[model samples]
Each structure stands twice: as C-alpha cells, then as structure tokens.
Target: MDNKEYKEYTAADFLNDPDFLLWCLDPDKREDLFWSEFPANHPETFAEFRKAIQTVGSVRLNNFTLEEGEKAELYDSIMSDYRALCSRRRLLRRRLFALAAAAVVAAGVVVPALLGVFRPPTETDASPARASEIRLISGRQSEHIASESASIECAPSGEVRINGRKIASAKPARMNRLVVPEGKRADITLSDGSRVWINSGSVFTFPAAFGEGERRVSIEGELYIDVTPDPERPFIVHNALFDTRVLGTSFDVNAYCDSNRPASVVLVHGAVEITTGDGEQVQLESNDMFSLKAGNYTVVKVDPSQYVSWKDGLFTFSSGTLERVIAQIAAYYRVEIVCDPDVRELCCSGKLVLFDDLSDTLDVLSDILPINCRIEQRPDGTRAVCVTARTN
Candidate 1:
C-alpha cells in the first residue's frame, strides 16, 4: 500500500491487510523495523493501528494439533468467512476478524465459546457506577459521608475526623480505606502531615499513622499527593503494575487499573523512582511523566499542570484527541460517553473548569470543539452522553 493508503487505513482495514497479517504471522527484521516506524510516520492512524495490534495479540490458540493440509484448508476457510462478513457489515467487521484470526492457523474446528469476541462488557469496561456516598472503612466499621466533597483528617493520636467532626478513633497502625465515588472528590491529611487529593472513583488505603520504617499507601484510581520530606523514611505509592517511591515531593499518580488506559506517574516537583512489576526501576525528574502499557515503560516531558490540575477542579489538555477527553469526563462523572468514531480523533486544546453539573462542562466542551453533545438512554438502563459532529 502507498503511504496515503496506509495512513487512511482503519483498524479493520489493518486487520484484513495481507502485509499486516504476514508481519503478525511470520515477522522478519525488515517488517519489524517498518511496523515500528509506521506509527511515528503516520500519527493520525496510530490509534487504529494500536487497536488492531491489541485485538490480534489478545487471541490465544491452545493445544490443538493439525496436519499441514488441514491447517491450509482451515486458513482459507477463515479468510473466506472474514471477507464475506466484511462485505455485509462494517460495524461488526472487527469482531468477526477476531474470531477468524483465532481459527485461521489452528487445525481444529472453530469454537466460538473459546473466543472473547462474544463476551459481554464487564463492569470495568463501562464507566464506574456512581455510588451514593463516600465510604470510609476501618476494620469492621464503615462510615458513609454524604457530602459532595469531603475532607478527612487522620491525627497522630489515631483519631479520624471527616469535615471537622470526629468519626472514628483507632490504633495508630490500623489500616483505613477511603472510597471516593464518581462525581465527587476528597482530600485527606495523613497522620504524618502528608496530604493527598483523591479523584473520583478512587480507593485509597493507608495506615492511620506512619510506622517507624517507611510510609506506604496503595491506590486503585488517581491521586495527587504531597509527601512530607523525611529522608529517613521514604514514601512509597503502590498500584497493581508498579510502585513509585519518593521523599518529600509532589506528584500525580494515575493507576486506574483499566485495560484501555495506561498507568502513569507525573512528577510535579522533586523526584521519584518507579519499580515495575518485574523489578525494573526508572527514575524521573521534575515535569516528567512515566507511562506503562503492555509491560513496557515510556518517559516523556509534559507540563505538570495538565495532569495535576484535576485537584483544583480543572481539566487541561493540549492537542488531546476528543476520544481521550471524553474518556476523562466519563470517569470523572461516572457517565457513559459514546463519541462517534468519525469525530473521535479530532484534536482540541483548552482548559475546562469541571462544574458540578455535567451538562455545564459539556456545554463548555461543545463550544470549544466542533461537536454536539446530547444525553441519551442506553438499553442497559443507564444514561450516556453521546458526542457527534456538529451539524450547524
């Protein structure tokens, strides 16, 4: 294919391309170099290319043996089915290709049960459900705070207070969990004087007081933390994929544990050393962002404000695609947002103040971009914001 043709290819087009299939099936050094450089050369098609790669990589062919002739026959059959399906419907082509790819090289009969293509979307696949209130859990006791935003304090004496009212008193070493539901935010002052601003849909676990050894906390969503500088006791933040260690510095950690999103750490100041699940350690300086995707780590320089601004009820982006911006809004408000694929890749730049009302924020976004936003009810009994190209 020519450069223009390759640049215009969608995920489905890439999956059905003979050259792409050859590279996936029988990779050579030349093809590896070419595919690796394709994204850099055609930035517009990078997302589609990445989607194709992930779809292909996730298919697992198990322990089925087939004769050479059988393999050839099965491959031809799968390709024929794929082509027939492609000609019928464009919306279902990717899912059909996934099933075809699974049985193409395998000798056994195609089994739809073994493929993930037919699986329904799980809870993680959708926007997190909005909880009625934030819950703080300590041992068997749970405290529910009904406020839109909450401020919790943990005193050195093992006393916990929410919004200046004493909630619970426990041992200094007792572990406590704070849950911030969607459409809300919270700030917590740890016993050691370190403060953390937790974002929506986040779960933060920390001890009521720091031990003599090291201060440690674990988070599943996102948070902006300012560590109390104590060289003797380094502060560490743990997530599913990696651990970030620092001393007396501020940084933003976005470890949402979502397959579609990469876990990243953005350093606002000071420095941090990240230890991956495989024990690979990387150090980051100020204004540096470290992102981990598919077991690989990448570091880049970015404006710290673009990431940490959420702590101040602001969303900032520069040349960010509409798809990503909508994803962020969906997570923040716990609202399902569906952006038209035709306009998903459109890029915009601006700062948006996240108002309490989601519509207010959407209004600002619609004004900034050439898009129209409307709320619609999905078949699943939930409401969603649908974004399409502006007609007027």
Candidate 2:
C-alpha cells in the first residue's frame, strides 16, 4: 500500500501523548495537557512531561488585554505606514477585517490544487518570496500558501512540491530548521528517504528537501531528525552558534539562542561532526551528546534515548541543575522564568509531564527539588514570578 493509504497513529494516541502529534500542532491546547500523565515511551517523554508544564506556567498573564485590545493595538501601530497602497489600504485602511468585510477570494483563477496548502512557519514577519504568497487565515492558523499555477504534491515518497517546481527534494542537508508550535509538528522526509520529526515549540529546517546534493539548514530551538542514509549529503545542522554535520543518523538539538552556553546536539544513531565557535570541534558517534560553551565543547556519552526523548512525545531531564531544567521548560512553553540564585543552583532530576499552569508546575518542582516555588503577584495584578525559596 502507498504511504498515504497506511493506517497511521490515531488521534487518541497523539492526544494523550505529550510528544504525540497533537501537542506539536496546536499551541492553544498545550495548557490543557501539560500536567496530565499519559503513557511514556522513554526518559525523553518524561522530560517533556514537566517541560510542557513549565512552558505553560511561564505564560505571563499580567498586562494581557483581550484579543480586541491586541487587534486595536496592531491596527494603531501599522495604520500610519500602511495607509497607502490599494491592496494594503482595503485590508486595514477601512478596518475591513474588523468589519467582517473581505472579498479577495479568487473564484475562477483559484486552482483546486491550491486548497489546504501547507507552507513553512515563518519567523517575525513572514516575508514570503515575492513570487509566492503565504497568508494567514482568519480562524485556522495555517499559513494559506496560495500560488496560482504551482501545484503542490506529496509524492508516494512523501516528498512535497510547489507548482511543478521542486523547491525541496531528497538530499542531505546542513542547516535545516522546521519550527512547530505547541500544537503542531511537521514530518519532513529527507532525500535519502530519512524522516525528521520536528517537535512543538521547536523548528527543524533541513536541506532534507534538497536535490541530489549535501543537505543543511540552520535551526533555532528543539528538533528531532531521522537522517536519511546518504554518503554525499551527510545531513548537517548549522546554527549561528554551532554546527553539526552527519551522515545517515537520527538526533536532536537544543540550540536556541537563549541557551546560556552553546547549543547541544545529541546523536541517537550514525556518525556526526559538531563544531563550536570556541574552536572546539569533535566528531560524535552514536550515543554521544555534545554541547558548546563560549569557547568550550563538552562531550559525553548518553543513553541516546534521553536525547530523542522528544521523539517519544515527552521531555525528561536527568539529574540536572534546577536552572538548567527550568530553562528547557521555559522555551518549550514560551514563558519567562525567574528564580533567585540560591534556589536556582539547586539540582533536580525527576520525571513529570508538561504542566499547564506555572503555579502548578512550581508546586511540583518544589515538591521534587529543595525549593519552594510560588508566584509573586505584581502591582499590575497578574502574578509574574516563579520564585524559588531554597530549603537548604
């Protein structure tokens, strides 16, 4: 049977799963599943359990106005610079969207093949190629990647297309970043027929879509990739902070810019090369986890299972410092974490699923670690602090 015809993992599997496909695709639902325990595949899933919680807990409710306030602010900020131009004028100049007045739909010219198109998530302003168009729909968050003549097809091989042009093909890649939100993750099959799983609150961009050549893409945040076996492309990852070049492997990278030290790359299988700007370069084989600091590269042998924990649909932290654990949770949940030095230095290693509330996460972290965490209500009314009081 073709890959499309295959019975895949069901919706229920993804729903109860912290790392299940559900949480990766929808950011809004994460808060609902953060603390609930579901079946876990490995230590990695354990990590994501608490990670999901910490992420949601970090959402600062302070100073958050209603959606209407947000919309008004957006309009105020852009109206001056956008008052001109016919297309721009109609959309915002008349507040057409607010008035529920829109008629840009292309009737006859619209192609049937263009429906339900999926484009890559964009950072900040999605400045799409001048030739192509990717727009945000009103209700659903999918970037409506509409192109006139270009037809997009996912071959039996799971390869994707734009029109007839092959923007990404099977190939080894160097720098690939595919970003997924709390409720979304994308499956990208590499040229060598390897599959890369991008986790939520993470991005996986690879030359995996490359033609017959070396593959690469720079990434920010977390990702899980199963590299296709290719001697030539030797799938590679490039971050402004670090680099990982590998041949036929599966691995994960936690290399966001906010990371205190260098980003980390952990290999589950295959051979790889990791280079840190601090002049530290090393080759990693299976079961190796490497990280870069300002100028230092640290390599260690890991269970490999820990690195690919996100792959199992959960995140787990081994006996790590409280600060370190919190950092990972903060990024996943997209929240700000604050802890004093005394409590921050405390070490913790335990298993918990992602938490939906910061207060709840704080309670759990406090229960497991030698600290008491609480939210300090600010003058603005929304509690902003995840204060940790050292028990020691």
Candidate 3:
C-alpha cells in the first residue's frame, strides 16, 4: 500500500476488517510490515493482545450443543493449527531462499512479523502509525533508542564476559535489547569488577568493548548490577524511557515497559544520576530510587534488600497495589493473572514468597489479606486458570 493510502487507514479500520484483523492477529504475519513497526515499541499492548488471542483460542464454546460429531470437528480445527505450526520448521527448511533486504537466510514461508521482524516506523508522531512505519511504535509511547556511543573497559584483572567468553574489559554490542529469557540469564563483570546478574525476560546491550570514553549500556526488563568503578568511565544504564548513570555502583532496574505510571530504578549503593526520556533528570544517592510517574519523578529512599530479594528467590512488595503486585507475580512465576475490581482495588503491603510455589503464596495472602480466592479452569481448557474472590 502507498503512504497516502495507508495514512487514511485507522486502527479501527483494520480492527473491523475481519480478514485484516486475522492477519494482524495472525501469529505468523510478516514482522517487516507490522511487528517491528508496531509491537516492538509497545510491549504491554502486545502482551495484552497475545493474551486476548490465547483467550479466544482457549475459550469454551459449547461444541457439545452442536450435532453429534460436531465436537470432534471443532477439536480437529484446533489440532490442525497445531500441526501446521509444527510443520513450520520442516517446511521452512525445505523451501528457503535468500533475500537482499534480509541477508539472513529465511524460508520466506513464515510471515515476517510473526517470525520476529521488528522495525521502527517512519512517522514518529503519527497516531497509531501505519502498519508499515519505520521509527515509532504505536499504542504506547517509549523513548527512542537514544545514545548509541558508550564504551567498555577492564578493571583489576578480568571484568566482563559475553556468550560464555570472558573479556578483560567488556564492551557490549549495540542492540535495542538483550533478551535473557527464562531458563537463561547472563553474567557479566564490568571494568569496575561489579558483577551483573541478569534475570530472565531481561535485555542488556552495549558496545562489545569500551574505549577512552564513558561506559554505558541500555536495557529493559530486570537486572542486578555490581559496578566496577573507574572514576573516568562512569557506567550508565540508558533506556528510551529513562537513563540511570553512575560511577562504581550497584543497583537494579525494572523498566519492563510494563507501565507508564512509574519506571523504577532502585539504587543499591553509590551515587547515580537518572534522566527521563522527557529530559527530566535527577540524582539518586545510595539506597534511594528515582521513579518516573506521570511526567514527573519521585525519589524515595529505600532498603537495598527489598529491591534485590528476588535474587535470593523471594519477591517482596512494600505497600504496593494489587495490580502491580500481580504483575510481578505473573512474571516471576510465569502465569497469566487477572484480578476483579475488588481484588484489583486491594492494596498489599509486606512480602510474598514466589519460589515456594503458587499455592503457598496464595495461602499466605488469602490468610492475611482477608480475601479468599480459588482458581478455576476456564470453560475452554487450554491450560488456562482464573483466580477470583472477595474479602471475607
């Protein structure tokens, strides 16, 4: 489609177009046309979208109400989708070609967006950018990938490592994200000898080697860093949304693109200066935090132990609302959690144990929080569970 034609289209237009919506929602759509231009910048919105599709795929529509063998027909329909996806790798291997634009070898059978092609849109401010923009992602506003130059360095002896290889002075590669998903995490030592423990769902990217300049890295999700201090090369954590720059410090960043209300940076030790994507900047002392909320940032002094208890396998929420708490639990334990108005309205204080299994944590919460809850299998059974209840 031409730029003129695409400009006239609205999100609602394609949303209402069943065929287009299916293509948009098609888990296999070519990412070149959509994914990078749309979803890459808006993780939360995409997460919700994937959740809705999962809901639709698993929703229990009464097939038993249909004619005798109709139930089997419905089952077969779902099974066919599974089989098709399983055959993707095999088919991709068989009919593959090299493209000039995409240097990487590809089958060209799987759609681009669905296979993980991400790109920024052309018009940065276009509300709900066209499906084929180049710079900005619609839905959620994120800081653009700013500051491409940051170097790495070496301290005392060995400092950083990459892909199982150790470097005396580590210079991270330039990338938008360093995805260390579950079942995997990264361990890197900075020139300051400060170690970084990257959790699952985390990303970290920097130059492969730092030079005669500042040490800087950009990231998202969650990471625990122990900085090795070089008075000259200050370590800076840069994100489109917020930037935390410091020299020789330890801290954790949870800028998961989860919410706009507040992007958090918890300082463990030393001093750091935080700058927001909006150009707002603040300096945080050891044990203090800079939280970006609603165009403004609030600095709060906190205990380092609270921010990093997750490293030891305990998740804690100090006087946070139910929604944020559930988000943390869902990510930590890897489950979809939804709360009712009442449950969402509930505010939780103190701590919760995640590694102990879901039932134990639920038992502890239900016992103390005056809310009795239970999980029920959805009508359409695709390993879906919903938890609901009210204050006793």
Candidate 4:
C-alpha cells in the first residue's frame, strides 16, 4: 500500500490486503520496517493495526488449513468482535468531545484549550525483539517453520501430526531434524508429551514418534529438556562426545562446538547417567554438572540457575573470564565482538538480565569494568563491536 492509502486504511482493510497478510505470515526485515514505520507515521490507527496483527497471529497458530467456507466464517466472527470493540470506543470518544467542548465554551477559549484537552496520540512502544524461526529438515528437503505454524498439541490415539498431517504412528521410517539458529530460541513438545526448550544455535533430531524399545534423540549445541516418564522405554539424548540416558528427568545441556570451553550437562531433577565416547561413565544427581574437557570427564556441584537461566532471558556469569562472557553475548545476539588482548583475560562475576537492547547490555558492562566499547564499521560495510581496555 502507498503512504497515502496506508494512512486511511482500517483494521479490516489491512487484514484484507494480500501483501499485509503475507507480511504477517512471514515477516522479514523489509516487512518489519514497513509496519514499524507505518505505525509511527500514522499513530492514530496504531490500535487498529495491532488488532490486525493479533488476529493474524491467532489464526496462524492453528496448524490445520481451513476450507473456503470455514475461512469465511472465521473471518466474519473476528470482524464481528472488532466491530463491537470499535463501537464502544467511538461512543467514549463522542462523550469526551462533548465534555471538552462545553468546558471550552464556558471559558471562552478555543484553539489552545481544545488542543490541550485532546492531544495527538503517539505510536505504541515495543520491547526488544528476536526472530525465533525454527528450521525443519525432512529427508532431503528443508524448510523454515514459524513458531505459529509448528503444531505442538498432541494428536489423538497414537497419531503423530505436524501441520495437520500424520507423519508418524508407532513406527517411523526417517528421522526429522530441527534447528534453531543464533539469536533465536524455540519451545517444542514431542509426540510423547516431553517438552524441550532449544537454545540459540542448536540442532535437534528425533523420530516423529516413539518406537517399541526406546525413545532416542540427537542434539548439537544446547537444550533444556523435561522428558516424559516411561520406565518401559528409556529416553536417551545423544551428543557429539557423550550420551545422556534417563527414564524421566529435567536437565540442561551445553555442547556448542564453537566454544573453546568444556561441554557440560547440568541435571535439575531425577537421575541421569552420562557415558563418554571413551568408555567413561558417571551418574549425576540433582544440582550436578558434568563437564567434559578433551578426553577427560569431571563432575561438580553447581547452582542450576547458572545453566538453565537462559530459558528465562538471563545470562548468569559466576567468576567467568571476559573472553567467555563476550562470546556468550555474541552468540545470544548474533553479533560479532572483537575483544582486545589486554581485556580478554579480565575475570568478572555478575548476573546480566538480557531483556534490553544489545547496546544497553554493552553499556552496563563498560560501566562496571575498565573497558571501552566502540561500534566499528568493517571494510565489507558490516558492523561489529570492538572492546578495548580503558587506558589512563
């Protein structure tokens, strides 16, 4: 839609536009810029624009495709509700205008007083946003799946379905892989009722349904899982260097390949047995963290918050080096951070709530430590943050 037309478009108009619907379905950078700018420039229609967005989000969450008649019925129902809400608001606006006019007339005031009584509204403020699209690999074909499009509700009577089609039941022919890239996270519920929180830059692969003997899945990077209990079928998690076996339990795994640090698993509840590729085995209890460095394995007691807090938008650092801390930040925000040699080895301890923009996080870090952060534009026209020690 052009700028002139966008200014006058109603919520229904936006919902009817094919381009607007496509943007709502698969929002990329260009769509994001257009919608963000549209609201800012035409704040009077911001509420209506948000209504359209929410309506589309609700519809997208249902995995099944609606027939033409069913789709029309759904649209009519939504529009009916919107019309009711708009009617109520319009009545309130009329009453307010009446009251303001009476007051202005009594005071013999016109322009300034009326403007003060009814000021123009501004665009709604939005918080920091991270696109969390999951990539699914089925056989040789791969597709990016939006969170709304991926179905999580368990199907009835031993059926495994995704996007309204049965993919597995009792026996499965192939394994399906799901990937969550950097700066994004995803929550998925397996066919067996187990829930998984896949962290950023992680890969997980599992069958569509459980087999007769065991339930098994493979992983790369990190995952926080709450496995379903079934003593008959043991649940197993396979990683690069080790395998975590359990019947029913909750645990966090960190095995990102890019990190120089040791790969570790932190158990929150129940019991888990970790077996290394080199024939080493260890059992962990609650609040236990098993770390694998090189070919050696070690177990230690640690606070579960330090390992599992990322699911709640937190980066907990307990006596960590500056290099490791910066690496974590770079991975979380999908940004490049170049740390000077002088400051890479500086050790620090703090809890960082990662709810704000990346720049805000860097500002807080610079304030607490003896470092300076600068955004540098590289020769390739890309930007990265360079962190150097503050010289006196």
RMSD of each: 19.4, 20.2, 20.0, 19.6
> What lDDT does the true structure give each of the candidates?
0.74, 0.48, 0.49, 0.64
The Cα error of candidate 1 at residue 312, in Å, is 0.3
TM-score, one value per model: 0.66, 0.52, 0.48, 0.57
Expressed as tens digits, the lDDT of each residue in 1-392 for candidate 4 is 55446654545456546467556654568877887687778897787789877655433111336789989986996586557657685443332322221111001112221111111111111111122465666677565654322433333233455444455343354676777655556566777889887776677777756667888898777889999999999999998789999999999988766435578899999999998998778999999999998887788998997788676445666666776677777766556777776667676554553423467557656645667988767797544788877884
- Where is the poorest 10-residue window by lDDT in model 3? 97-106
Clashing pairs in 4: none
User: How close to the true structure is residue 65 of candidate 4, measured as C-alpha lDDT?
Assistant: 62
lDDT of 3 by residue, 231-314 (tens): 888788876588888878789887655452256888887888887777777888889877776677788888877677665334
lDDT of 2 at 61: 19
In Å, residue 197's CA in model 4 sits off its true spot by 0.8
Relative to the true structure, candidate 4 has a C-alpha RMSD (angstroms) of: 19.6
Residue 300 shift from truth in candidate 3, angstroms: 2.2
lDDT (Cα, tens digit) per residue for candidate 1, span 141-229:
98988766677899989999887679769789888888887777889999999999999878899998888999999988899999999
Which parts of model 4 are misplaced by more than 4 Å? Answer: 1-133, 146-173, 318-324, 333-336, 341-351, 355-372, 375-384, 389-392
The residue-level lDDT of candidate 1 at 119 comes to 12
Q: Give the TM-score of candidate 2.
A: 0.52
Full-model lDDT, candidate 2: 0.48
Best by lDDT: 1
